[model samples]
Target: MLILKLTNITKEYNSRVILNDINLSCKNCEMIAIKGKSGVGKSTLLNIMAGLERATSGEYYYNEILMNDKSINSLSKFRQANVGYISQHSPMIPELTVLENICVPVWFEKDEEKKKEYMQQIESLSMLFEINNLLDKKINALSGGEIQRAGIIRSILKKPQLIIADEPTAALDDETALMILTHFNFLKSEGAIIIVVTHNDIVSKHCDKTYQLSKEGLLLIS
Candidate 1:
Protein backbone atom coordinates (compact mmCIF):
# COMPACT_ATOMS: atom_id res chain seq x y z
CA MET A 1 0.00 0.00 0.00
CA LEU A 2 1.17 3.53 -0.61
CA ILE A 3 2.37 5.08 2.61
CA LEU A 4 3.74 8.36 1.35
CA LYS A 5 3.11 10.58 -1.66
CA LEU A 6 4.58 13.91 -2.68
CA THR A 7 3.35 15.99 -5.62
CA ASN A 8 5.17 18.87 -7.17
CA ILE A 9 7.00 19.62 -3.94
CA THR A 10 9.26 22.66 -3.99
CA LYS A 11 11.56 23.93 -1.29
CA GLU A 12 13.42 27.22 -1.41
CA TYR A 13 15.49 29.46 0.83
CA ASN A 14 14.95 33.17 0.20
CA SER A 15 15.47 33.27 -3.59
CA ARG A 16 17.50 30.09 -3.84
CA VAL A 17 15.62 26.99 -4.90
CA ILE A 18 16.89 23.84 -3.26
CA LEU A 19 14.26 21.38 -4.59
CA ASN A 20 11.92 22.16 -7.41
CA ASP A 21 8.79 20.32 -8.54
CA ILE A 22 9.62 16.96 -7.03
CA ASN A 23 7.22 14.06 -7.03
CA LEU A 24 7.57 10.80 -5.17
CA SER A 25 5.40 7.91 -4.05
CA CYS A 26 6.45 5.23 -1.59
CA LYS A 27 4.79 2.03 -0.62
CA ASN A 28 5.01 -0.21 2.41
CA CYS A 29 7.82 -2.76 2.52
CA GLU A 30 9.92 -0.61 0.20
CA MET A 31 13.38 0.78 0.84
CA ILE A 32 14.22 3.99 -1.00
CA ALA A 33 17.50 5.86 -1.05
CA ILE A 34 17.82 9.54 -1.84
CA LYS A 35 21.30 10.20 -3.17
CA GLY A 36 23.10 13.40 -4.06
CA LYS A 37 26.37 15.20 -3.70
CA SER A 38 27.08 17.27 -0.57
CA GLY A 39 25.44 20.53 -1.63
CA VAL A 40 22.25 18.96 -2.99
CA GLY A 41 19.17 18.90 -0.78
CA LYS A 42 19.06 15.21 0.10
CA SER A 43 18.96 15.88 3.82
CA THR A 44 16.48 18.69 3.30
CA LEU A 45 14.17 16.34 1.41
CA LEU A 46 14.27 13.78 4.19
CA ASN A 47 13.71 16.48 6.79
CA ILE A 48 10.68 17.68 4.90
CA MET A 49 9.28 14.16 4.77
CA ALA A 50 9.94 13.73 8.46
CA GLY A 51 7.96 16.91 9.07
CA LEU A 52 10.98 18.67 10.53
CA GLU A 53 10.86 21.18 7.72
CA ARG A 54 8.21 22.61 5.42
CA ALA A 55 8.27 22.96 1.66
CA THR A 56 7.57 26.33 0.12
CA SER A 57 4.94 24.77 -2.15
CA GLY A 58 3.30 21.45 -3.11
CA GLU A 59 1.57 18.62 -1.37
CA TYR A 60 2.55 15.87 1.05
CA TYR A 61 0.28 12.98 1.91
CA TYR A 62 0.91 10.30 4.46
CA ASN A 63 -1.49 7.35 4.52
CA GLU A 64 -3.77 9.39 2.29
CA ILE A 65 -3.99 12.16 4.90
CA LEU A 66 -3.03 15.65 3.88
CA MET A 67 0.02 16.67 5.87
CA ASN A 68 0.44 20.12 4.38
CA ASP A 69 -2.54 21.45 6.28
CA LYS A 70 -2.05 19.53 9.49
CA SER A 71 -1.34 21.53 12.62
CA ILE A 72 2.07 21.29 14.26
CA ASN A 73 0.60 19.46 17.22
CA SER A 74 -1.19 17.04 14.93
CA LEU A 75 1.93 16.35 12.93
CA SER A 76 3.95 15.91 16.10
CA LYS A 77 1.47 13.32 17.35
CA PHE A 78 1.52 11.55 14.01
CA ARG A 79 5.30 11.45 13.94
CA GLN A 80 5.52 10.22 17.50
CA ALA A 81 3.19 7.36 16.75
CA ASN A 82 4.06 6.31 13.20
CA VAL A 83 7.41 7.82 12.17
CA GLY A 84 10.88 6.84 13.35
CA TYR A 85 13.61 9.25 12.28
CA ILE A 86 17.31 8.41 12.54
CA SER A 87 19.05 11.68 11.91
CA GLN A 88 22.41 12.21 10.19
CA HIS A 89 23.96 13.12 13.54
CA SER A 90 24.05 10.94 16.60
CA PRO A 91 20.67 10.93 18.31
CA MET A 92 22.09 10.04 21.71
CA ILE A 93 21.55 12.38 24.61
CA PRO A 94 24.74 12.96 26.57
CA GLU A 95 22.91 12.86 29.90
CA LEU A 96 21.27 9.52 29.20
CA THR A 97 22.76 6.05 29.32
CA VAL A 98 22.67 3.92 26.21
CA LEU A 99 19.59 2.02 27.31
CA GLU A 100 17.83 5.17 28.39
CA ASN A 101 18.57 6.85 25.10
CA ILE A 102 17.09 3.94 23.19
CA CYS A 103 14.01 4.03 25.35
CA VAL A 104 13.28 7.70 24.77
CA PRO A 105 10.72 7.01 22.06
CA VAL A 106 8.55 4.99 24.40
CA TRP A 107 9.10 7.19 27.43
CA PHE A 108 5.81 8.99 26.98
CA GLU A 109 3.72 5.84 26.81
CA LYS A 110 1.22 6.01 29.66
CA ASP A 111 0.10 2.44 29.50
CA GLU A 112 2.15 0.28 31.81
CA GLU A 113 1.58 -2.89 29.81
CA LYS A 114 2.60 -1.30 26.50
CA LYS A 115 5.64 0.30 28.07
CA LYS A 116 6.74 -3.04 29.45
CA GLU A 117 6.23 -4.66 26.06
CA TYR A 118 8.32 -1.96 24.38
CA MET A 119 11.12 -2.44 26.89
CA GLN A 120 11.19 -6.16 26.18
CA GLN A 121 11.36 -5.42 22.45
CA ILE A 122 14.20 -2.99 23.09
CA GLU A 123 16.16 -5.67 24.89
CA SER A 124 15.64 -8.09 22.01
CA LEU A 125 16.70 -5.47 19.47
CA SER A 126 19.82 -4.60 21.46
CA MET A 127 20.86 -8.21 21.47
CA LEU A 128 20.21 -8.52 17.76
CA PHE A 129 22.31 -5.44 17.07
CA GLU A 130 25.04 -6.73 19.43
CA ILE A 131 24.71 -3.75 21.72
CA ASN A 132 23.40 -5.60 24.76
CA ASN A 133 26.78 -5.35 26.49
CA LEU A 134 26.93 -1.61 26.13
CA LEU A 135 23.38 -0.85 27.27
CA ASP A 136 24.56 0.17 30.70
CA LYS A 137 27.41 2.33 29.47
CA LYS A 138 27.27 6.05 28.87
CA ILE A 139 26.70 7.32 25.34
CA ASN A 140 30.20 8.84 25.47
CA ALA A 141 31.74 5.43 26.02
CA LEU A 142 30.54 3.83 22.78
CA SER A 143 32.33 4.07 19.43
CA GLY A 144 30.79 5.84 16.43
CA GLY A 145 29.60 2.63 14.82
CA GLU A 146 28.21 1.35 18.08
CA ILE A 147 26.33 4.60 18.59
CA GLN A 148 24.94 4.55 15.06
CA ARG A 149 23.79 0.97 15.42
CA ALA A 150 22.23 1.82 18.75
CA GLY A 151 20.52 4.82 17.21
CA ILE A 152 19.06 2.56 14.51
CA ILE A 153 17.87 0.07 17.09
CA ARG A 154 16.26 2.89 19.03
CA SER A 155 14.46 4.13 15.95
CA ILE A 156 13.07 0.72 15.04
CA LEU A 157 12.20 -0.50 18.53
CA LYS A 158 8.82 1.18 18.27
CA LYS A 159 8.09 -0.64 14.99
CA PRO A 160 7.09 2.59 13.35
CA GLN A 161 5.33 2.30 10.01
CA LEU A 162 7.66 4.79 8.31
CA ILE A 163 11.37 5.02 9.06
CA ILE A 164 13.27 8.04 7.77
CA ALA A 165 17.01 7.56 8.13
CA ASP A 166 19.38 10.35 7.16
CA GLU A 167 22.96 9.28 6.34
CA PRO A 168 22.62 6.30 8.66
CA THR A 169 25.79 4.56 7.55
CA ALA A 170 27.82 7.66 6.71
CA ALA A 171 30.53 7.13 9.32
CA LEU A 172 30.74 3.36 9.54
CA ASP A 173 33.27 1.03 7.98
CA ASP A 174 32.20 -1.35 5.21
CA GLU A 175 31.45 -4.25 7.51
CA THR A 176 29.42 -2.19 9.95
CA ALA A 177 27.57 -0.36 7.22
CA LEU A 178 26.61 -3.66 5.64
CA MET A 179 25.43 -4.94 8.99
CA ILE A 180 23.16 -1.91 9.43
CA LEU A 181 21.83 -2.25 5.91
CA THR A 182 20.97 -5.86 6.58
CA HIS A 183 18.88 -4.80 9.52
CA PHE A 184 17.21 -2.19 7.33
CA ASN A 185 16.30 -4.92 4.86
CA PHE A 186 14.74 -6.87 7.69
CA LEU A 187 12.66 -3.85 8.59
CA LYS A 188 11.54 -3.46 5.01
CA SER A 189 10.35 -7.04 4.87
CA GLU A 190 8.26 -6.40 7.94
CA GLY A 191 6.25 -3.78 6.06
CA ALA A 192 8.00 -0.55 6.96
CA ILE A 193 8.68 2.29 4.55
CA ILE A 194 12.42 2.87 4.87
CA ILE A 195 13.74 6.07 3.33
CA VAL A 196 17.46 6.67 3.57
CA VAL A 197 19.36 9.79 2.55
CA THR A 198 22.94 9.05 1.63
CA HIS A 199 25.93 9.64 -0.66
CA ASN A 200 27.31 6.13 -0.24
CA ASP A 201 26.97 3.72 -3.12
CA ILE A 202 26.74 0.71 -0.82
CA VAL A 203 23.76 2.18 0.97
CA SER A 204 22.01 3.12 -2.24
CA LYS A 205 22.70 -0.23 -3.86
CA HIS A 206 20.95 -2.07 -1.06
CA CYS A 207 17.78 -0.05 -1.35
CA ASP A 208 14.94 -1.22 -3.61
CA LYS A 209 14.93 2.10 -5.44
CA THR A 210 17.22 5.12 -5.60
CA TYR A 211 16.29 8.73 -6.32
CA GLN A 212 18.69 11.51 -7.08
CA LEU A 213 18.01 15.05 -5.96
CA SER A 214 19.23 18.10 -7.84
CA LYS A 215 18.18 21.71 -8.38
CA GLU A 216 15.53 20.56 -10.84
CA GLY A 217 14.07 17.92 -8.49
CA LEU A 218 14.12 14.17 -7.79
CA LEU A 219 14.96 11.71 -10.54
CA LEU A 220 14.70 7.95 -10.34
CA ILE A 221 18.08 6.32 -10.81
CA SER A 222 16.90 2.74 -10.45
Candidate 2:
Protein backbone atom coordinates (compact mmCIF):
# COMPACT_ATOMS: atom_id res chain seq x y z
CA MET A 1 0.00 0.00 0.00
CA LEU A 2 1.28 3.48 -0.85
CA ILE A 3 1.46 5.80 2.14
CA LEU A 4 2.06 9.55 2.35
CA LYS A 5 3.52 10.78 5.59
CA LEU A 6 4.50 14.33 6.45
CA THR A 7 6.48 14.72 9.63
CA ASN A 8 6.82 18.10 11.27
CA ILE A 9 6.55 19.91 7.97
CA THR A 10 7.17 23.62 8.25
CA LYS A 11 7.34 26.30 5.57
CA GLU A 12 8.81 29.75 5.94
CA TYR A 13 8.80 32.72 3.63
CA ASN A 14 11.65 34.99 4.63
CA SER A 15 11.03 35.13 8.39
CA ARG A 16 7.31 34.28 8.29
CA VAL A 17 6.25 30.75 9.01
CA ILE A 18 3.53 29.64 6.62
CA LEU A 19 3.13 26.07 7.86
CA ASN A 20 4.07 25.31 11.45
CA ASP A 21 5.08 21.84 12.43
CA ILE A 22 2.32 20.29 10.39
CA ASN A 23 1.88 16.55 10.45
CA LEU A 24 -0.33 14.30 8.37
CA SER A 25 -0.53 10.69 7.30
CA CYS A 26 -2.68 8.80 4.84
CA LYS A 27 -2.65 6.04 2.29
CA ASN A 28 -4.08 5.37 -1.14
CA CYS A 29 -7.89 5.10 -1.67
CA GLU A 30 -8.53 7.89 0.84
CA MET A 31 -9.95 11.24 -0.23
CA ILE A 32 -8.99 14.15 2.04
CA ALA A 33 -10.46 17.63 2.14
CA ILE A 34 -8.66 20.64 3.58
CA LYS A 35 -10.80 23.68 4.33
CA GLY A 36 -9.62 27.10 5.37
CA LYS A 37 -10.22 30.77 4.82
CA SER A 38 -8.34 32.47 2.01
CA GLY A 39 -4.65 33.32 2.50
CA VAL A 40 -4.13 30.78 5.22
CA GLY A 41 -1.36 29.04 3.23
CA LYS A 42 -3.71 26.34 1.94
CA SER A 43 -2.11 26.50 -1.49
CA THR A 44 1.33 26.50 0.07
CA LEU A 45 0.56 23.31 1.93
CA LEU A 46 -0.76 21.74 -1.23
CA ASN A 47 2.39 22.77 -3.08
CA ILE A 48 4.57 21.20 -0.44
CA MET A 49 2.53 18.03 -0.59
CA ALA A 50 2.79 17.95 -4.37
CA GLY A 51 6.59 18.44 -4.21
CA LEU A 52 6.35 21.78 -5.99
CA GLU A 53 7.76 23.47 -2.89
CA ARG A 54 10.19 22.21 -0.32
CA ALA A 55 9.34 22.29 3.35
CA THR A 56 11.67 24.45 5.38
CA SER A 57 12.32 21.95 8.12
CA GLY A 58 10.66 18.54 8.04
CA GLU A 59 10.53 15.15 6.45
CA TYR A 60 8.20 14.11 3.66
CA TYR A 61 8.02 10.44 2.97
CA TYR A 62 6.08 8.48 0.39
CA ASN A 63 6.09 4.78 1.19
CA GLU A 64 9.19 5.26 3.36
CA ILE A 65 11.05 7.10 0.58
CA LEU A 66 12.42 10.49 1.54
CA MET A 67 11.33 13.35 -0.71
CA ASN A 68 12.61 16.40 1.11
CA ASP A 69 16.21 15.84 0.17
CA LYS A 70 15.71 15.13 -3.50
CA SER A 71 17.32 17.42 -6.09
CA ILE A 72 15.19 19.51 -8.46
CA ASN A 73 15.54 16.99 -11.27
CA SER A 74 14.75 14.09 -8.95
CA LEU A 75 11.75 15.95 -7.59
CA SER A 76 10.55 16.61 -11.11
CA LYS A 77 10.81 12.92 -11.87
CA PHE A 78 8.91 12.11 -8.71
CA ARG A 79 6.08 14.47 -9.63
CA GLN A 80 6.00 13.15 -13.19
CA ALA A 81 5.67 9.59 -11.95
CA ASN A 82 3.29 9.98 -9.02
CA VAL A 83 1.49 13.32 -8.99
CA GLY A 84 -1.67 14.55 -10.75
CA TYR A 85 -1.99 18.20 -9.77
CA ILE A 86 -5.04 20.33 -10.62
CA SER A 87 -4.28 23.98 -10.15
CA GLN A 88 -7.12 26.41 -9.34
CA HIS A 89 -6.70 28.08 -12.73
CA SER A 90 -5.87 26.77 -16.17
CA PRO A 91 -2.18 25.91 -16.61
CA MET A 92 -2.48 25.23 -20.30
CA ILE A 93 -0.86 27.11 -23.14
CA PRO A 94 -3.25 29.75 -24.47
CA GLU A 95 -2.33 29.03 -28.09
CA LEU A 96 -2.88 25.28 -27.97
CA THR A 97 -6.13 23.46 -28.65
CA VAL A 98 -7.84 21.92 -25.65
CA LEU A 99 -7.05 18.39 -26.86
CA GLU A 100 -3.41 19.30 -27.45
CA ASN A 101 -3.20 20.88 -24.04
CA ILE A 102 -4.74 17.81 -22.44
CA CYS A 103 -2.09 15.69 -24.14
CA VAL A 104 0.78 17.86 -22.87
CA PRO A 105 1.61 15.75 -19.83
CA VAL A 106 2.28 12.60 -21.82
CA TRP A 107 3.64 14.23 -24.96
CA PHE A 108 7.06 12.71 -24.32
CA GLU A 109 5.99 9.13 -23.72
CA LYS A 110 8.29 7.04 -25.97
CA ASP A 111 6.65 3.69 -25.33
CA GLU A 112 4.27 2.79 -28.18
CA GLU A 113 2.09 0.72 -25.84
CA LYS A 114 1.69 3.49 -23.26
CA LYS A 115 1.00 5.95 -26.04
CA LYS A 116 -1.94 3.83 -27.22
CA GLU A 117 -3.26 3.54 -23.66
CA TYR A 118 -2.85 7.27 -23.13
CA MET A 119 -4.82 8.00 -26.29
CA GLN A 120 -7.58 5.66 -25.17
CA GLN A 121 -7.65 7.33 -21.75
CA ILE A 122 -7.75 10.77 -23.33
CA GLU A 123 -10.82 9.81 -25.38
CA SER A 124 -12.59 8.32 -22.38
CA LEU A 125 -11.78 11.18 -20.04
CA SER A 126 -12.63 13.89 -22.55
CA MET A 127 -16.06 12.30 -23.10
CA LEU A 128 -16.47 11.74 -19.38
CA PHE A 129 -15.70 15.36 -18.59
CA GLU A 130 -17.95 16.52 -21.44
CA ILE A 131 -15.15 18.33 -23.27
CA ASN A 132 -14.82 16.16 -26.39
CA ASN A 133 -16.79 18.65 -28.46
CA LEU A 134 -14.46 21.44 -27.40
CA LEU A 135 -11.27 19.60 -28.23
CA ASP A 136 -10.48 21.76 -31.22
CA LYS A 137 -11.08 25.02 -29.38
CA LYS A 138 -8.03 27.01 -28.31
CA ILE A 139 -7.42 27.43 -24.59
CA ASN A 140 -8.00 31.19 -24.85
CA ALA A 141 -11.42 30.55 -26.38
CA LEU A 142 -12.94 28.37 -23.68
CA SER A 143 -14.96 29.60 -20.72
CA GLY A 144 -13.72 29.18 -17.14
CA GLY A 145 -15.75 26.05 -16.55
CA GLU A 146 -14.64 24.51 -19.81
CA ILE A 147 -11.01 25.25 -19.01
CA GLN A 148 -11.42 23.78 -15.53
CA ARG A 149 -12.76 20.51 -16.94
CA ALA A 150 -9.95 20.37 -19.45
CA GLY A 151 -7.43 20.94 -16.70
CA ILE A 152 -8.97 18.14 -14.67
CA ILE A 153 -8.73 15.74 -17.61
CA ARG A 154 -5.08 16.65 -18.24
CA SER A 155 -3.96 16.13 -14.66
CA ILE A 156 -5.70 12.76 -14.25
CA LEU A 157 -5.13 11.20 -17.66
CA LYS A 158 -1.78 9.85 -16.52
CA LYS A 159 -3.35 7.72 -13.74
CA PRO A 160 -1.32 9.23 -10.94
CA GLN A 161 -1.19 7.87 -7.43
CA LEU A 162 -1.47 11.30 -5.84
CA ILE A 163 -4.24 13.66 -6.96
CA ILE A 164 -3.69 17.14 -5.52
CA ALA A 165 -6.30 19.71 -6.42
CA ASP A 166 -6.64 23.35 -5.46
CA GLU A 167 -10.27 24.48 -5.50
CA PRO A 168 -11.04 22.10 -8.35
CA THR A 169 -14.75 22.88 -8.62
CA ALA A 170 -14.74 26.64 -8.20
CA ALA A 171 -15.68 27.42 -11.78
CA LEU A 172 -18.16 24.62 -12.51
CA ASP A 173 -21.85 24.41 -11.73
CA ASP A 174 -23.04 21.92 -9.11
CA GLU A 175 -24.06 19.35 -11.70
CA THR A 176 -20.74 19.49 -13.46
CA ALA A 177 -18.93 19.51 -10.15
CA LEU A 178 -20.79 16.40 -9.12
CA MET A 179 -19.90 14.76 -12.39
CA ILE A 180 -16.20 15.36 -11.77
CA LEU A 181 -16.32 14.32 -8.12
CA THR A 182 -18.16 11.14 -9.06
CA HIS A 183 -15.25 10.33 -11.31
CA PHE A 184 -12.92 11.12 -8.44
CA ASN A 185 -14.83 8.54 -6.44
CA PHE A 186 -14.02 5.99 -9.11
CA LEU A 187 -10.37 6.97 -8.97
CA LYS A 188 -10.39 6.65 -5.20
CA SER A 189 -11.76 3.12 -5.45
CA GLU A 190 -8.89 2.35 -7.77
CA GLY A 191 -6.37 3.18 -4.98
CA ALA A 192 -5.62 6.82 -5.79
CA ILE A 193 -4.93 9.19 -2.90
CA ILE A 194 -6.91 12.39 -3.49
CA ILE A 195 -6.28 15.66 -1.65
CA VAL A 196 -8.43 18.70 -2.34
CA VAL A 197 -8.28 22.16 -0.83
CA THR A 198 -11.71 23.74 -1.00
CA HIS A 199 -13.84 26.31 0.78
CA ASN A 200 -17.07 24.72 -0.43
CA ASP A 201 -18.80 22.42 2.04
CA ILE A 202 -20.22 20.48 -0.90
CA VAL A 203 -16.68 19.47 -1.73
CA SER A 204 -15.97 18.39 1.83
CA LYS A 205 -19.09 16.24 1.93
CA HIS A 206 -17.66 13.98 -0.74
CA CYS A 207 -14.41 13.32 1.08
CA ASP A 208 -13.68 10.53 3.56
CA LYS A 209 -11.93 12.90 5.97
CA THR A 210 -11.99 16.67 6.44
CA TYR A 211 -9.55 19.07 8.10
CA GLN A 212 -9.42 22.79 8.57
CA LEU A 213 -6.06 24.47 8.27
CA SER A 214 -5.28 27.38 10.53
CA LYS A 215 -2.17 29.36 11.41
CA GLU A 216 -1.45 26.64 13.95
CA GLY A 217 -1.81 23.71 11.53
CA LEU A 218 -4.22 20.96 10.47
CA LEU A 219 -7.25 20.42 12.69
CA LEU A 220 -9.55 17.46 12.16
CA ILE A 221 -13.20 18.27 11.74
CA SER A 222 -15.31 15.21 12.52
Write out the backbone clash pairs for model 2: none
Off by over 4 Å in 2: none
Top of the candidates by TM-score: 2
Please, what's the RMSD in Å of model 2? Answer: 1.0
lDDT per residue as tens, model 1, 137-158: 9999999989988888888888
TM-score per model over all chains: 0.95, 0.97
| lDDT score for residue 190 of model 1 | 94
Per candidate, the number of residue pairs that clash is 0, 0
Off by over 4 Å in 1: none
Q: What is the overall TM-score of model 2 with all chains considered together? A: 0.97
Query: Which candidate leads the pack in lDDT?
Result: 2
Cα RMSD for candidate 1? 1.3
